[model samples]
Target chain A: MDRASRGLPLLISRLDKDYAGKAGPRPVLRGIDLEVEAGAFITLIGPSGCGKSTILRLVAGLDRDYSGSIRVGEAPIRGPDLSRGMLFQEHRLFPWLTVRQNVALGAFHCGLAPAAVDALVRELLERVGLAHAADLFPSQLSGGMAQRASIARTLAGQPRLLLLDEPFSALDAFNRLALQLELERLWQRTGITMILVSHDIEEAAYLSDRIVVLEADPGRIRTVVENPLPRPRDRVSPAFNAIKARLFEALHVDTGAPFAVPTDPAPEEAIP
Target chain B: MSMEVSSGGLAPPGAAEAPRAVPSRAGTLSHPANWRRAASHVASVVAPVALPLLLLGLVASAWEAMAVALHSPLVPHLPEIGKELARIFRGGHFFGEMAVTLLRVGAGFTIAFAVAVAAGIAMGRQKTVAHFLEPAIIVGLTVPGLVWALLCVIWFGIGLTGAAVAVALSIAPALLLNILQGVRAVDAELLEVAAMLRLPLRKRLACLWLPSLMPALLGGARLGLSLAWKVVVLVELFGLSSGIGYQLNSEFGAQNVAGVIAWTLGFAAVMGVLEYGVLAQLEHHLMRWRRTAQV
Candidate 1:
């Protein structure tokens, strides 16, 4: 297949990033390669600071200072644009804004009229099934509702690419499952390309067409597994657990002391 | 660091809070929760008027007891002070004098509020500017108001210019501090959203700064107003031909204690009303949205 003949959008070639600190230069990521072509959910899973987030940031145009070039239609990435929206790990909803206002905030730089902004906010809120909580402030909302509002906020710009960075990590088990279902439904309805970064192997297996696993110690791609699991993904399904168990074993876990919060009595030297 | 009470019990923030079913307020006046809030609001207004009246009563009874003890005609009784208050309120010269003093204080206050808030916003945005302004604001805050009066008198002479300068010098430090704090206290995320949108100052001020600055700004304004008045009165006492401060001076010199008390009580009442009515109303209106913004 002549991939160029299809005009399939992707970030081609290796991505490199170096951390320049006051003390000295410390290299974080090197020789990273990824391909996210049209309308696909790409999951990048790894332990913390594996530069999985750095990759997403590079694609989103949030980080441009790097050794490699990211060619978006022959133009170098300059700054954040309306073509992409990102969801941070924390909901990051504006405390001063109601759910509706927080969602509308995404449309602020999009140059949309007030009526159109309102309509988009309403539509996204309804799609996320959080229309009932639209009037509530972010502080008044529950963990799930806040994340729903965050999703709505990201979607308000009508971006071609959605970057989700462990958005449902803060939720409980049941709520995370519901949010995953909601996200799947949203992607189905919108046909938007999403590159999600998560540490949860099951979540990646359930949601992504393919999972790209990166190993720790200045991370690099370790595995790319095509998840052939059927939709309406059930956690109790035999094949589902089989895939989950396999991914879980393959997961580096990196419980290497640093991942554990203090008060666990882990040896300090065992970390990073 | 602090405990917040929910319907069921106390809980810290950043915890999962489930909504609980609870009955309505017990009664409009009898409800322990909002009733206390309502009563406090009423008391803030009522206390200003009641305290002075009761204070005058107690002072009068003491003065009467002292008059009898000393056999001296110096200390005036409650009735004498009431008569003096009646005279001051009705007398065109005294009322006219208060109006003049108020004009000077008001002018200085408006200028101080404008400069302080603008400086605060500018400083908040630029670290370099804040670095320079920090030392100056601290100096102003620590310097005595009397020194400002003396300096202004030398610079502007003993007139409205001198009076206005005195008042501004007295309040500029405090006003600057509050305005800076308001700007500093504004949520960084909200500011980020505003910047991302490229919002204009008016929109930013209306939608962001006004709500964010209300409590601090109002608090600053109240202090500025009171401090300005004191500065104005002190200037008038030292230099002006006519004002409440002048009246107090003349009354004290003539041993008319009743007249001096009358002027002091009258000035304190005016301060109370300005605080409760003008400044507090602005605070309430500006922070109305904030009341329900977060849990």
Candidate 2:
């Protein structure tokens, strides 16, 4: 798709954030710096309270009370814009609206004619496999279906960058795996600069082009691991396991725990 | 990128088909289980109306027995009140009076709703607005409907304006409180989503704020309407020359027990229709999404 080339590179420098605690200003994020190339898939994986989601929120411009330089392409984000879309842990579909109406909200500012907007909504619903459930309210949908609709809503604006804050953490294993695959496919097709915050090691290994591991207690990036596995990575492949093993080592280094070597078992044994 | 992996175990096969196969037509009614289901549905629908009517019947019978035994002029027989009620319906004068009263109620309630919503939203959204309005709202809540009616009658004189203003003043504070609570309780997460999407203010109000406030709006309407009805009648009784309230006042002056009872019952019936027939149906339709959530 030609839109694949529309992704805008993001730059963040010297980012510092603080929260007003009872004692004094508590540092949440400190001296964070990262540069993401256009159309790259990046995952921020870390333990809880490591400020991964906070970073995503900052990049989305939902919270601007931070000392940093965050630029999408060449423009500094003043507030949320149509060019950047975000998905939360919860589906966040408006409970009062049907799937179609909720998705249409994303395109409300696109200045399209009503008919064109309708067609675009239908196309997005179809792409998300929610065409059958388009008229269903958020309450009626299963967890996975609701999240799919949310993805459709996020994609409706054709954003050049997408931020996901553990978008599938609430789902069952089966649904999580399904959505992960769906997200990977969407990333490949749209080539949107994507950033996901997750603590799931395998999830980070499976989807990220680069995983930025973070440490808590005045949160900052510990290391960035570049994935060597090719597209359509097999879960049981030796290379895939190696990358997962490397991520485990990086994560465990902060906790002062010895990294357990991953036992390379047969594919049949790995299926469990 | 493989489609095969996601296609399985996402949505169970035939899950969507189950709701489609529901037997909605009479063709499937002949089945025994379907027959039982239909009977149960009918029973549930009828039970609420049936129980109230049964109690009313018993009360009426007891009143009639007592009236006959006493044989007093003060306690008219049940049949006499029923005859008076029928006459009020048949006589065209009563219809005109009822219509005048209904128009006043409509005007007053509309004014109250508009003012309450405006003030409620302001108070709910801004801390300073809420602080400034809180004491006045509390005082408004404490004042009786009778005082408002009498004050409006004194100020506006014997006219539609007196009755309508009385009703609005008496009811606005309660409705404002209801709407304030709803606005304050709006989900913050959904709002963040609205912000992240860059939804315009107008769209946010329509899709998010208004729908989120609907239950409270409807609840306020129900309470406000009931209060407005009583206040409008009180204002009309003392000040206005034409209305159901005026007729009841005249009946009281004449010491006609049956006439007063008939007018009271007739007004109650109209109020019931407005509440159940109009407001209840609207609430059901607007809140259908919430009902589906429970299932």
Candidate 3:
């Protein structure tokens, strides 16, 4: 057997989750198998109640009652750890805390010196374009700005892998694009593995190197498509359109229009 | 919507002008200043005597009118009551009585607040604790101030200890209920977020649960303080020899209507001062994070 820590950032096999519903123990996820390479960007695209979030929570070590074997590097996650950070859909910033103070909590368990923590918080706020709002409380922030502050807080922990659970779902299109670009830049700069759960097909295509499409009713992966498009991929480009169309088809969305052919298209019908 | 309305109001009344034209900005400059001037004029007329002061004045006049209409010596006029109050203060009987009552209330309140918080936090966080205390808290809530006062007099035999015990027992349940509700109302999402962040138990309690439960705690403290006074007075009237309640009892027995009204007024004045000077200020300082409605 290969050692767990050899270059693989994450591995999961036969993952299953059952929720105690009013009727009975309802199955939410079943027979999931996935492997994440180090520094890879993977997006789990699924409909509501498809258990994409459940998977993210499981990997983030927030949920432990699942029947899955998940390994992060050499370690099996038993509970939330400092090395794996997760961001929820809501900003969830502590209302009593100022922006800087909220971000400061990210590295609280790291035992860094006070000066170092302050410096880290300042740097993260500056990176997220919220340095000016550092002294303001969460209630004083706009929605987009609060989300950016949340992102800064998450990143301050210096997690080796970041799990984002529909982090941009509540944002407007303009703010969404800006955040997506910011996230991509951060990912590229940090070279940290990221697994994002999202229903936005275009977002999955735009930010991720690989997209895992999940089907509902005992949510399981239906397809995993690798995007061959290069970085800074234009949303309107033929290559981007083709990849998006193929994803739509995998997710069973009928675009009702044919996509423009890519100049260098894959011969396979899909990359699964 | 308001922003759109204000911007529309700021627009120049010209069909040919662009929406973002500089001429429109110049035309709009004086509009808000004029509106501000009108608002200030109205505020200047009404702001000096706000609703609370008006209501207080109304209540005072009504109280005086009722005393005159009733034609009973017991229902003293406001001026007569005020005169008795001044006499009591001038004779130096007021401070000692006030001191005795305050000490009992302060001691009782401190004990109740401390125990209720510890017990409330336990009940809020643990099912077993809540299950054990639920029946007792319910019973306590229903029991009256007079009942606790009588029970304390019987058990401890009519002293400061008895008065303090009665006050604590009578008021603890209110604080407990408020604290428990506050703890339960804390956002579940924030708890999950704290767990994901792997905050230490101490940090979680201090930063998350405590802050979330603050409004309830402070509210309970405010109510508990007022209730403690009432219970202490009842206990003192029934048993003790030296407090404001004892003074009221003596005055009532002597049929000195002005004296009874004077002691009652003194108690009210103390409560009002404490509420305004201490509790209200504490609440404003602690809950400064809360946003108030704007006009």
Candidate 4:
């Protein structure tokens, strides 16, 4: 249980990234600066082209081509490490392996003995409410079940910092809400510093301690809003709506006009 | 209800009764309709075996008719060939020859598989390795198995060594091509997952590469084994003095057409057992996950 407080702080400064476009190297991210405290939940919310996911990938060391500094607990990321676990939008489970095997793979490099690894896998499956589905392959799992199994796999690594790239965006509204609750509970229990990339305003408001709003076209941080809402947040609460309205305003400042699609027009109208 | 009644009224009594009677008749075991269904079900089950049997019967009848018409010793009847096959099985020397041929095939095929896998993986992973080996693979594929068999016989001077070498040289390119395609076709997303996990090379091979490449490897093995059989027999026919191919050669030398046919039949039967019995079973077991996933 001591590992519950093992979350590592992250620091990023003057980060710049470019992709090899058809014409030439095109800038994707520019002047990106952010800091995350240990055991804090941070959500990066932006429009579609904003380099939020790219920033997550860079921090995870999946891409090290960026020019700047990204340090996790005083060490610059050389490459992907066990300390950092990532979840993609897709479950990304190996179809050949059973759920048990996939979860066990997360613990492969942890240097645990075979029996210990087996016990860990069992505990993880149980924790994720997937004990009965342990022997099932990814194909046999429903979308929500598969994502839960993926979460178990990531947790098996005992990561200090968990990066989620729209991990529940593919799920239906009900499953997405269910998983969001589960993810919040997981973050609270494990105390892992979590960074999530999402476009969903409510999702960002519900989970994050600090929501970093980003602007597209050379993605850069626009503002970071501190959430005053308490834990076990109610979706319909006025306090939650206030924070969502702030995030929505931050997201639409660049467009001369207001965002056309108002999720909750009541809050926006009230603000005006 | 009114529409149904009107339609029922519009139809003839016999037509209405006939539709109901058809289902009732089909439900009865003794009915002609039920008998026809049972016959069709049995036919479906037996069709695969029956079609091949019918073809074999046709071939035999044609051979028998040709033998009767020509009245030649070279064109032996099916019974004469069957008798010769029985004679080959009865003789202890046939077993020894078969074992030798099989051993050579096994050795050659193993060599081909090992070399192909290593080379294929290297070529698939590294562009430099691929560029360096592409021309050699192309040339190897282009050259006929007969040419390799002749060269190997000349180089190794007639023995198991010569025959095994010929088989390996002849089939390795095709196997390599198969394995290379497999390696290339490996899922990139899964690989990215492995990289993100920082899985060790050993684990990566066991969990990711091996399973991903399994279908291709099995496919290559099947193709390579069949090719190995033909090449080994071919090399034995010309180079070695003891094998089924050697027996065929000896019979042909003596103008014993029945003996040649019998040896070929024996070889074909063994190949059938191996293809269906061993390789197929292994493939089914290894790929059981895929079958279940589909279900």
User: Considering every candidate listed, which one attains the maximal TM-score?
Assistant: 2
lDDT digits (tens) for residues A1-272 of candidate 3: 12223123999999999999999999999999999988899999988888999999899888899997999988998898868988989999999888899999988988899999999999887777677788888877777888888988887777888999999999887677767777776777677789999989889989999999999998999989898678866776656777887888887776777654343444444433
Candidate 3, which segments miss by more than 4 Å at Cα?
A: A1-8, A258-272, B1-50, B293-295
Model with the higher lDDT, candidate 1 or 2: 2
lDDT of 4 at A77: 92
Docking class of 4: incorrect
Q: For candidate 1, lDDT tens digit of each residue in B1-295?
A: 0112222111112233332224564557666777787888999999978997898779767878887788656766667878998998884766687788888898888888888989999998899999999999989988888888778878887788888878887899899998898898888756644553445677678768876787788889878887887778778778887777778888889898889988988888877777778777876765443535224
Task: Name the candidate that leads on DockQ.
Answer: 2
The order of the candidates by lDDT, greatest first, is 2, 4, 3, 1
Q: Please rank every candidate by TM-score, starting with the best.
A: 2, 3, 4, 1
lDDT of 2 by residue, B108-166 (tens): 99999999998998998899999999998999999999999999999999888888889
Over the stretch A234-261, how does candidate 4's per-residue lDDT look in tens digits? 6776567767777777877433435443
Evaluated at residue A214, the lDDT of candidate 4 is 92
Clash pairs, candidate 1, are: none
For this target, which candidate reaches the highest lDDT against the unseen true structure?
Answer: 2
Clashing pairs in 2: none
Q: For every candidate, how close is chain A to the native chain A in TM-score?
A: 0.85, 0.92, 0.92, 0.92
Q: How far in Å is the alpha carbon of A49 misplaced in model 3? A: 1.2
- Candidate 2, residue A183: lDDT: 83
